[model samples]
Target chain A: MNIHEYQAKALFEKFGIAVPKGAAAKFPEEFDTALSQLPEGTTVVKSQIHAGGRGKGTFKSGFKGGVKLCKSKAEAKEVAGKMLGETLVTVQTGPAGRKVQTVYFTTASSIKKEYYLAILLDRATSRPVIVASTEGGVEIEKVAHETPEKIFKVFIDPAYGLADYQVRELVFKLGLNAAEQKAASKLIRGLYTLFWETDASMVEINPLITTTTDGVEALDAKVSFDDNSLYRHPEIVALRDLNEEDPKEVEASKHALSYIALDGNIACLVNGAGLAMSTMDIIKHFGGNPANFLDVGGGASREQVVAAFKIILTDPKVKGILVNIFGGIMDCNIIANGIVDAVKEVGLKLPLVVRLEGNNVVAGKETLAKSGLTITSGDSMADAAQKIVKLVA
Target chain B: MAIFVHEKTKILVQGITGSFGARHAQLSLDYGTLVVAGVTPGKGGQFFEHNGHKVPIFNSVADAAVATGATVSAIFVPPPFAADAILECSDAGLDLAVAITEGIPIRDMVRVKRAMQGKKTRLVGPNCPGLVTPGTGPKSSGGCRIGISPGYIHQKGHVGVVSRSGTLTYEAVWQLTSKGIGQSTCVGIGGDPVNGTSHLDVIKAFNDDPDTHGIIMIGEIGGTAEVEAAKWIKANVKKPVAGFIAGATAPAGRRMGHAGAIVGGTEDTAAAKIAAFKAAGIEVAVTPSDMADALIRAAKAQNVKLS
Candidate 1:
């Protein structure tokens, strides 16, 4: 759903918003070509990863910064060389961090002022809201907590879209001049249109900076589109970088399952998103760490269950497995049969705990009981977690 | 005394003949729901027969409502066209619409929510299990189900359950039903990152219903809706409320499958929600099955007897 900064800036340009002259380089060898295309000035080399806090992020190679300012093209190439292939560890990216697969070479500009602007869905109101503040280049969350007065928000009615007066009001609140206000108004309107047209969940311009040229520029952009709407935008879906994602997770998605790997000993397989979370919660409550989170969706067939089992076993850290399902429209008997068949085919070595409830539950329990496998049957959600955690411990 | 659907609630199936719609429609009709008509664009003048019972199909909700006098609609349309279906239902001036479609674009839902403003139609979910009220009269057309929640797992009782998750709703209902507790109604508001209904809406409905003496609220991480509901319950709701939140062990940033299950900060986490519930004098269940025990205690505290 999230696109890199270069892609976001390109989309911004398509929407008539101005961004610093930049080019995305996938390889360090292309760094010279990227620097040559950009405006002749001090260039900024930014490592493009999903997680933020790149300026202060450290590379696995002990390189100083994920983002660096280079006064010369040679320095730009050197910095890109350091960041192009290394894994970046920021405050947002965990210790393992993300590999720097792409880098953006942008012309560094002298900023007259920096302001934060974003369009996002306000859950409480069920409306897309435009949030702006004079303070930028720092954590907006901190500004919200400490100096709430500096932040301003305008909730745009989906029926009417963003009004011209609303944009002017935000511009006025941010203390922009007549010329800058006019320019800011245009940019805001374009950004809002882009958000609406693309079904973007969030379009953030952290530090929508005023350049020395006295014009508005989206300094650092982050655009995330609504995943549900991607079907209408095939062009956007093509922007997905599989290399940036966990391979196991990509594989799980191919099977119509949701999986997120974690550092734990217990592997959880549950139907329904909320139940999966509860399963993990109870696992931790019983003093067990879940190695991964996997949701086989409301309905799972024998093949899907086998696929899920195989994915869990792929994690060498998994000590035990827990299968929790509450079948409503989904039949519990199908789940039980799938479990038995999975263990038979995959040859499970780790202890497995399963708790089935709802439709055909009696048959489901009977099926699991007669499987003659070494799987433990849980009486309830709590019992399943306790059983799996204890067995793993 | 149920909150939404009961006897006399005529049901219509939107996107009828679609795999999900047809399957649930047949199941609901068998379970005793009064299904009067089906609507699929260009499939008008057709008859969808199941179990020797024929349902007349209409081109639009407007024509269907006019012909069948259907007041409620359960939608199983695909996500891309779901918003338009909801708008059509609302436009037809239906009493309630249970949207079973998931993955509706937020932008589309934003427009849908706006279109629903001040409208007669009350929208339940875009990604939910739907609403159910048990104990309708046999002659009544409103069946045992309005959504995907199993009809067999419920019994007519005093507890009203409203949840944000689909399967978790069934789990709680199963626990209560197995323990001899019955439900007046159950609603899943869906897990969309931004939805049409909220915990507050369902809780307020339960609060006003005389049949619902105790309430079960199931929430998860990611939104302040639960905390807000707790505050509202403390001030207005007189019935004993039992609460449970999923994702207590979930880490930050990772969305637990549900679009709305991402922990935004420390505030929306399970610990914060449970603390809010306890602070509001509601019984908090540590586990899903513990909901039965909590509900029993809640009902007992209010001098409401089970059985």
Candidate 2:
């Protein structure tokens, strides 16, 4: 759903939003080629990753600053070399961080002023809103919390697009000069169009700069599209970076199961999203950390249950597995049998706990009991969590 | 006596010829819902027989509505065509349209919401578990089940249950039902990032209902809906309310199962919503199991007869 900064910038350019010339390079050796496309003066080498706070992020190689201001192509090459193959740890990226597979090299711009601009769906209003502020190059969340008055918002009516008066008010509140205001209005309009056209969930340009040379340019870009709408846009789906996502998650997606790996030893497999979260919460509340959050969905067939178990077992940290299902449309017998089959196939070594409720629950429990597997079946959620915690702990 | 659908509310099934649509349609009909008509493009004049009874299928919602006089529609259309189905139902001047489809693109919903500005239809769940009114009319034998949740989990009682998650709604309802605390009606506003109905809409309906004595509201981390609902309850609702929120231990920035369950900002968290509920004099359930007990206690304190 989230695209890299270079990809976002490319989208910005495609939408007629001015952005500095840049090229993405996979290797340090290709830095020269990328730099040649830029103004050849001062270039900014930005590490390409999904997480924000990259400027302050440190590379695993002990190279400071994910973003490097390089005066020479050799310096850019050195920075890119240090970052291209190294793992980056930012405030946004967890302690384990993401491996930087690509680096963006772009021409540095002379900025007279910086402004924060983003277009996101506001939850309260249930509409797409444009958020702008005079403060830039800092965490907008912190700015909003500290100086709430500084942040200005304009909610867009999706039916009519961004209203003319709304854009005019936003630009005026941004406090730009006459010519700069004109350009800002055009840029904001184009960005809104891109947001609507591409079905983007968020389009953020931190430090939308009023450059000394150009009228306006996006210094940094982060864009995420609505995943549900991706079917209508095949081109957007192709931009998904498999490297940036957890392998287990991507694999789970292929199987239509929702899985997010966590740092724990108890792997949880639940039927629904809400139930899955409650399962995890109960596991944690009972003093057991869940290894992963996995929801097999409502209508999971036996094959999908098997696939979910396989995905959970793939995480070697899993010391115990808890299968908590409240089958409605999902059959309990299929899940119970699938667990037995998956355990037989994967050669289950970890302690297993099973809890089945809802329709066909008695049949499901009977199926599990008849499977002759060493599974601990619990009566309730609390009982299940306690049993799993005791076994894992 | 229920908030949304009851015995007299004639139901129409959209996308009726499809497997998903037909499955739930049959289930709804079997549950004693008066499913008079079905809509499937190009399947006009077809009959979908269920339990020895034939329900007529039409090419469009307008034709289906005109023929069947069905005011309520349950949508089983796929995600891509779901918005159009809602629009069609809305365009036909249906009273309520329950959209059971999940993964509807927010863009399409945005347009759908815009088109519904002054429309007669009230949309529920582009990714929700539909509404069920358990305690009204003769046909409410299985409680007029229109959504995905099993009818066996519900009973005819005074508590009004509204939730954001479907399975969780079932969990809460099952607990309430098993403990002899039957529900008057239960509604899943849905767990999509952008949905049609909200806790406020459903709670307002519950507040106006004469059958609903006390209410059990289930929310998760996301949106300011719960917080806003708390404020509304403080101002308007007279009934005793018990609240439960899932995903208390969920990690920040993680989409805890539901697309709409993400913690977007500081205000949209379990802690924040729980605090808001407490501030509004609503009983808060700490754990999922505690929800039924909490609601019972709240109802007892307010002189609500649970049995």
In terms of DockQ, the best-performing candidate is 1
Interface RMSD of 2: 1.2
Chain A TM-score, candidate 1?
0.97
User: Could you give candidate 1's per-residue lDDT for residues A1-393 as a string of tens digits?
Assistant: 889999999999999998889998998778878888976668899999998999998998898788899997778888888888799999998898999999999988789999999998888898888999999988998998999999999999888988888987999999998778888999999999999998888899998998766799999999988878999999999988888788899999999999999899999998889888888888888899989889998887888899999999999999999998888777889878889999999999889999888778899999998999988999898888888988988
Q: Cα miss at A202, model 2 (Å)?
A: 0.3
Pull out the clashing pairs in model 2: none
TM-score of chain B of each: 0.96, 0.97
Estimate, for each residue in B1-307, the C-alpha lDDT of model 2 and write its tens digit: 7888876789999988889889988888877888899998998998999888799999999999999899999999999999999999898999999999989999899889988988878999878889888744342354677778777678888889999888888888888888877788899999987888889999999999998888999999988999999999999987989998888777887887778888878898888999999999999986777788898888778887865
Q: Which runs in model 1 stand beyond 4 Å of their true positions?
A: B136-143
| Number of backbone clashes in candidate 2 | 0
Candidate 1 clashes: the total is 2
Position B83, candidate 1: lDDT? 91
TM-score of candidate 2 to 2 decimals: 0.98
